[model samples]
Target: MTRNVARNRSPFSIWLAVISLCTAGLVGTYVLFVEAPPPRRIVIATGGKDGAYYRFAQLYANLLKSEGITLEVRSTQGSVENLKLLMDDDSDVRVAFVQTGIANSEQCDSLEALASLYREPLWIFYRGSKGIDRLTQLKQQRIAIGPEGSGTRGIALQLLKANGLGEKDDEFSALAGNLAAEALERGEIDVAFFVAGVDAKYVRKLLRDPEIHLAELTHAEAYERQFRFLSAVKIDEGLLDLQQNIPSHQIVLIAPAATLVAHRSLHPALVSLLLKVATKVHQQGDLLSNVGEFPSPKLTDLPLNPEAERYFRSGPPVLQRFMPFWLASMLDRLKIMIIPLIMLLMPLMRVAPPLVRWQTRRKIYLWYAELRRIDLRSIDGMTIEEADSSLEHLHRLEQQIARIGVPLSYMEEYYNLRLHLNLVRSRVLSILRGEAGHSQPGSHPGFRTEGGESTLAR
Candidate 1:
């Protein structure tokens, strides 16, 4: 009974071992893949509230809100200020609409571009058709080159330096947007350099003004070649207004793309969410771009984010395409655990059942060793008393064999062990009969065994 009780733990212990292996694999997988959840709220630096950057940022914020993220818009002076906010390590602005050329390679170490959303045209408006078609023509003139630290100032300064404008001092007005346009109307500045979208109120107003002429950049292709970030755009005549023939002729201009940039340390999940928002907000065409031309990963201002690179290369992961954004993101994180979990389970599944069967077979096979010992003992020549002793021992062995328990699958082996026991019993009984026959002279040979069976006849 003690042996049976002790041996019964084999199957239970094996199962426990399988459970432990599964648990350890799961824990290791979880450790490797689990990460802090993406921030629920974030801030983006958009340019002036009335500008295109701010307008498009609102669209991003609106779409992000549907995904359970709060988008706070931090308005700044322009793209230069936006870039500064993104570069600041202590700032909360993780995203911004940055102009392509405003930041240099050295300053972009901590910045990454999610995509280029649209073109931010550099519009040069002046008081006359001086046919002023080049950057060198307005060197010493009183010009409104937007405010200090604005994208307009950045591009204008670069162009001035490239064109050999030696005294690039405040020969320029520090005005921008409506103020610059108002100044141009009042003849306060001879020329105004405004970097804005095609639909900007001031840009449209300046374009229609009869006194102000939009300068046609004749060397646009050269500028594009020199500054790789610039793309030469052709604005066809009458495209803006058919009846009025606004501009009255085709105009060529050089412009930089408006990039959606973020800090390098921004969370990857948040990056994924921002990419989706970019697609929703900027996938359509504007006056200059064709439909689905923007929100492109190509020629972005800052280094392209790794996730954005993969997204543009092969598209979103399958889960993201079919499931909700948050749901798919969570599943993506958990996906790393699947292979390890399966690896742990497969071996346990393959080995455990066979191990249990071998353990059960051991229980039955152990009795065969005992049966062989008893069968050998029965063949020894012995007196009637020895024969009676051997018969009693065999009877006790049969009782134990009957008590052996096994599963339904092992029942055949269980019964087979008992049959062998009975065969050994018959051999012992024959020896007892032979001994009793030889000692028939003793009257006391009519002895009874433990079960009240008299041994006189057999």
Candidate 2:
């Protein structure tokens, strides 16, 4: 009884070994060939100290870390420097929040956009002896265009040049936004030109002071015409507040839209995830964007990524909308795995049955060959005595096949092959007993006669 139990377990043990090897091969294939998760740490190129970009980057850093992403918000001069960092692979920076119209045309090839966060209104406040309402009035005064390589400086230069003014015509100072505002308050700088989002701390402080007036762009329409990138917007009276009743009249401003730019090599999954986070962060009903409307890819030098463009047009994918954040992220990483899994499973399901039958029937088919050999030898003008001996050999072959063991899994195909062997045996016996005619002229009982030959013999 113990010997029989060991014999039964031998096949199971062999199959277990085969399945173990197959499982190992499958796991190794998935690990080596499937898509990998994104880098754990990333750098977010932002602006210098005390700027709007730097503050926003801090918020972004906090938000990303919650999603298992480490963000290094590196401070620099501003937009131009941010673009440079993303374009240089040696820096290992992947993303940047850049202002539009400040980037060089050549740098655009290395960088594209993920989203445009908000519009950066250029707020030029001047505390001069003369009351100035237009940019043309600052032609000869010492004006601070913002720090060198800063987004403010880049926009300041263009706005001045648009109004038929240049650094040669006016004295230009390269100072940070807060520094410029303090200098203008101290009566050191004649005018301060700041390009930043609304609610910039230094700008708010300057707005409350009675000594300084927010310079309105009287030539806003003309400026927008000259520089197509500039948008003319009006700051309505008491728009900042209802109680202060400040700016009793409307203030016109010329501004450029701030865009979110990154390297073209950024992963598509990361872009999708970033856009999902940005939608939550920026789509609120604030002074900048309306509810359910933000993080747009509408304005940028480089074209939007194909997947991002599709997502913006349609909305978040189904898995993202319903699944938890981390699960959705894992599903995004496993996007390519779906294809390989289907490819692996579908064929196994279709061909396993036939494959198992072919493997198990090897010994059964060997007996059929022995029966055929004996029938051929007896057909060489043998007497009835020789024919009876051949019939005995055929019977023994059939008994051996009937006694062979087959597992339950392959029982159907195993029985079908046996049925075919039985049919062949019956026809061979009838021919030997002279109950059926062998014909080269027509189809025979044992096999079809094609081209004057049996199909099996041929």
Candidate 3:
């Protein structure tokens, strides 16, 4: 019973050791395979309450929230300030809705566009009697160039200044979207400019009234020539209201596209997810946009992220669906570990049998050394009984070789070495018993004599 207990305990102990080893291996594998933690929440830098960016964020925030992602929409001074927030480390803001023409300076870095949400049309509305045929006409007039630090203000100031107008040329008022539109309607301002997306809610309400008239960019071609980034778009004469035929002629407008920009450090999976969401939110049939019309990764002030570039062309990875976001992240991290694993595992599977054969034949090889020694003793004319004792030692070694445990993969080579050991043992014994004369070690007698002399001398 005690023997039985000990035997049972031995296997248990071995199993425990195996379990411990496997557990350690599993833990190490998990450490290597485990994914990074997902981001807790994302902060989006949007424009002020009355602008298109803030309204767009409301929709995007809803879309991202549905994907288990929290979006903190922080109101800012529009594109320029949004870019600043993205650059500032303490802000923790990850994404921004920036109008394209705003970021003109060279100080920006580590930014990439996820997609172009919409075209931020530079809506220039003037009081009917101001007699403004071009942007230059607004010179020396009371003009509201949008709020300070706003995207509209930045682009408006730049465009008007190109036509030789600035704060000095006109009575510039820095006011919010609703406030500016209201001031223009009340005749408090001669002209008001809003660089916002198409059918801007506030601008539309003002345009519907008879008191305010929408200004057309008569010099759109010249504007596009001066600013290559600006595109000359024509708002059809009655496109806004086909039945009413509201405008008498086509309205030519110079506009900049709005870009969905993010920091370069954003995870590829997250970028892919954002891009996917942007596609669904912007490209799909929504109130303000049409199908196949949005989420363009092209209109950005900064360079495109490589993943965003690839995703724009090829789309998302398949493993992203089945794998957790964090796990998919790990595959990207350990991209280098794959080569070493393949190299090490291949030789282990292929050469294991050879390694076992080498080990099993080691004892048999040792006996060959002994047989050589006994053969030398016979060559030196040692007595038969003395040589027999060496033969007996070799026989014991042969028995020991047969008792060794080796897997069947190595059995052929093991048995072949055993056969060689037996044949050599018999040959040495026959010579020792004087049953056969001296057999040369090989074909060379001088080499054999020298080898035998050296063995006897040793």
Candidate 4:
């Protein structure tokens, strides 16, 4: 009984396997053709650990960690070094915050901007009893333009050169950040230049100091025109500290926008994720920027990424609207494959059912053809011995059909074939009993012995 059951299921099992293999092949092909999954981890180059770039990068790392991505933040000297890490093909760095004008077209061919995050004002603090209104007045004084490879130094040199100072000038110093602030306070440097956010602790602390004065750029609009990336921004009176009136008056400043930049080949989904986090981090209004002014699609030194452009224009990808980050990312990767897989399977689905039906019917019909051959011999003049052999052949064909397994839909045909076999067997036996001459042609429902000819009745 067990053997019979196994035999009954054999054809279905074979066909099921065939269908399974075809499905597997399609899935494998899609996996091979689709884009590789986004990296599970990425590295970002930021400025010194105490600067705004490093602080904001840490915030991004926390946000990305919640989405199952590991964001490794590497602290560098500043924007100049950040650009170096991004441009190096051998480096693992994929993202960084770079200041505008720090990178030029020749240096940033392999990089793209996600968005401009915020404005970094160039603050020049001088210790003086008399006001210093221009870069030219401080040309001969010892000045801290930040350390080498820092964005502050890069922009300071540009501004200083416009006022006739250069590498030939022996009065330039290389102090930076807290060090630069300290040098000015201690009178080691007569002037200190800092490029940083208004909210930076050092900048706020220096603004409150009575001895140090924040020099206002009298020709801020001219500087903005000279350097297209620079914007003329104003520090309103009493905005920093209402009680102390830190600036004591409205101050005009020239600033460059800080941009979130990445390698040109960074994954599109990751680009979107970074942009989303940037908007959350920098959308608030500060002294220089109005609310929602940043994460702006403002063109910077690096060309804007196409994905970042689309995201700013239309919002997040459609799948990401309702799903969690990891699931949305997986679906976005797989979305390209959906249409191609559908194109492949539709025609197969249309033809598969009929092909199966024909296969099952053919199994039953083949034995009927054999039965017809034996029936024809009985009519075409077989003797008693030949009739006996034909009868035994018909019985063997019957046993074969009985053991064969087919779907229930084909059972009617199976039984009808068996009924025809029985009719032919009866006629063959009659011939063996010497009674073939008495039976009229066409008398049997399934067999036709007229003119000693056989017809396939199925």
Whole-model alpha-carbon lDDT for candidate 3: 0.70
Supply the global lDDT for candidate 4: 0.82
- Candidate with best TM-score: 4
**lDDT of each residue in 238-264, candidate 1, tens digit only:** 877778887698988899998888888
Clashing pairs in 2: none
How does each model score on TM-score?
0.77, 0.73, 0.69, 0.89
Kindly list the per-residue Cα lDDT of model 2 for residues 1-458, writing each as its tens digit: 00111122323344455556556656776698766666667788888867777777787778878777777889898888887788777988888888878876574677777777777888888884467877778877888987777888888887778678987767899976788889989989888888877788888788888888888767888877776667787778887766886567778888777777778777666677677777777787456556765778765655677667877988777777887656776777667666656665666545555555554555445455665565466455444445445555555655665666777776775576567656655555555445324334333333456665454321
Q: Say which prediction, candidate 2 or candidate 3, comes out ahead on lDDT.
A: 2
Worst 10 residues of 2 by lDDT: 1-10
lDDT of each: 0.81, 0.71, 0.70, 0.82
Task: Report the lDDT tens digits of candidate 3 across residue range 173-283.
Answer: 987588888898888998888887557677767767887888876788887777755667777677666676755577778878888888877766688777777787677
The regions of model 3 sitting more than 4 angstroms off are 1-38, 285-290, 321-327, 330-336, 351-458
Model 1 residue runs over 4 Å out of place are 1-16, 33-39, 128-131, 166-168, 269-272, 359-406, 414-458
lDDT (Cα, 0-100) at 264 in candidate 4: 86
Q: Candidate 1: how many backbone clashes?
A: 0
lDDT of 4 by residue, 36-95 (tens): 778889999999999999999999999889888899999999988888999998999999
| Pairs with steric clashes in candidate 1 | none
User: Ten consecutive residues with minimal summed lDDT in candidate 1?
Assistant: 1-10
